[model samples]
Target: MSRKLPIVLGILFCLITNHSISQVIKEVEGLYYNTTGDLYTGTYTEFYESGNKRIEMNLVEGKRNGKITLYFENEKIQEVRSYSDGLMDGTWITWNDNSVKIAEATYKRNKKHGKWYIWDDNGVKRYEMEYSEGEKVGTWYIWDENGNLLKERKF
Candidate 1:
């Protein structure tokens, strides 16, 4: 074989292998500031090592704004929360790894402001709580997995 032919073949092999390896080595990829205390506008996303989506959120001048969604490594929806101008607002919902609704709560300016519901990992309702601007104000309930009324208390 010609000496020039061997050198060209070696270059081609290195380029192909390096490209594929770089794709996996990139663990964290997103559109954000490169320095601390810097906020980039628009949506930014993160992913798990397995390439599954981890979190996706929006930012306006580096403050949390709009809706944020999180997911499980298995690609299931984990939580969906809303925000306004860097504060938690509107309804927030969460689910289990099995894709079952686990809990839900409301917030206004980052404080709990309304009813909250919770369920066990087996998807059974376990609690119903009320909150007023981060403070409990009314009746709260608890239940067993068999749908039995376990307890009730007023705050």
Candidate 2:
């Protein structure tokens, strides 16, 4: 092989791999883009001033396509949600700073569309609801801190 062949191959490799690896991503109109003005297709992450990860998300073709996670300043996960084509399309969950889950819900095309739940800071479930295309449907239940059902409402 020619000596210059190796040098040319190395430069080509760096250019081809640069976008595939994690690099800073930019969001415009809710879509992600790379510095080269191409649709971003990689993991995007943001960090807190204290050096802890603040958010991490996977993107494909400039749209959020997989799990997106947000964290508290102390590194505890604050929320976890799924997206497809930049819209909420799967299970979404959130927790308090104390690491206790506060809400859980499902979405389809950015609309609430399945069983939903909410809990109090004490880690007790307080509400259980159902949704169909963002409209309340079925029986919704409310509970007290002791887990006793307080009421049920039908739509």
Candidate 3:
């Protein structure tokens, strides 16, 4: 009986340890990526120190392949962008700290492409420009903060 007692205790300890290990695995199974590690496919939510949502991003097969949203510390949306295979490939919108729309731009394969518009903090149009392969290649417009047309230039 004395020898059987040790063996029984050992078996019980093993069972407890194995159960804890499985619990740890379950806790980490949803993590798609860790900052110190390579890419992973998963969704992650990050928070600001003030307990507000700072960013929400999604990953697929270790690459950023979906929408990303960023927020100011006050919880206002700062920017929203979409990515494909880790490259910016769609519309991106940015807002000022006060929640005013500051810019709207388009991207293609990580390069600025198509039309882009900029606005002042007061919500007035500042400029509109077109780009090809990251270079300003078409007509560009400039306007005053009060919506007054200032100039038009062709690049």
By TM-score, the better pick of 1 and 2 is 2
| lDDT of predicted model 3 | 0.80
Assess candidate 3 and give its TM-score to the true structure: 0.74
* Model 3 bad stretches (over 4 Å): 1-32, 35-38
Candidate 2 error regions (>4 Å): 1-23
Q: 1-155, model 3: which lDDT tens digit per residue? A: 99899999998996685554333221234334444465456775666655577877777866667799999998899999998987899999999998899999999999999999999998898999999989988889999977888999999
Model 3: how far residue 44 lies from native, Å: 1.4
Write the residue-wise lDDT of candidate 1 on 99-124 in tens digits: 88999999999999999999999989
lDDT over C-alpha atoms for residue 80 of model 2 = 99
Against the reference, the lDDT scores of all candidates come to 0.81, 0.90, 0.80
Cα displacement (angstroms), candidate 1, residue 5, comes to 18
- Say what the RMSD of model 3 is: 10.7
* Tens-place lDDT digits, model 2, residues 19-90: 443355778998889888999998888776565778989999999988999999999999999999889999
- Model 1 segments more than 4 A misplaced: 1-38
Candidate that beats the other on lDDT, 2 or 3, i.e. the better one: 2
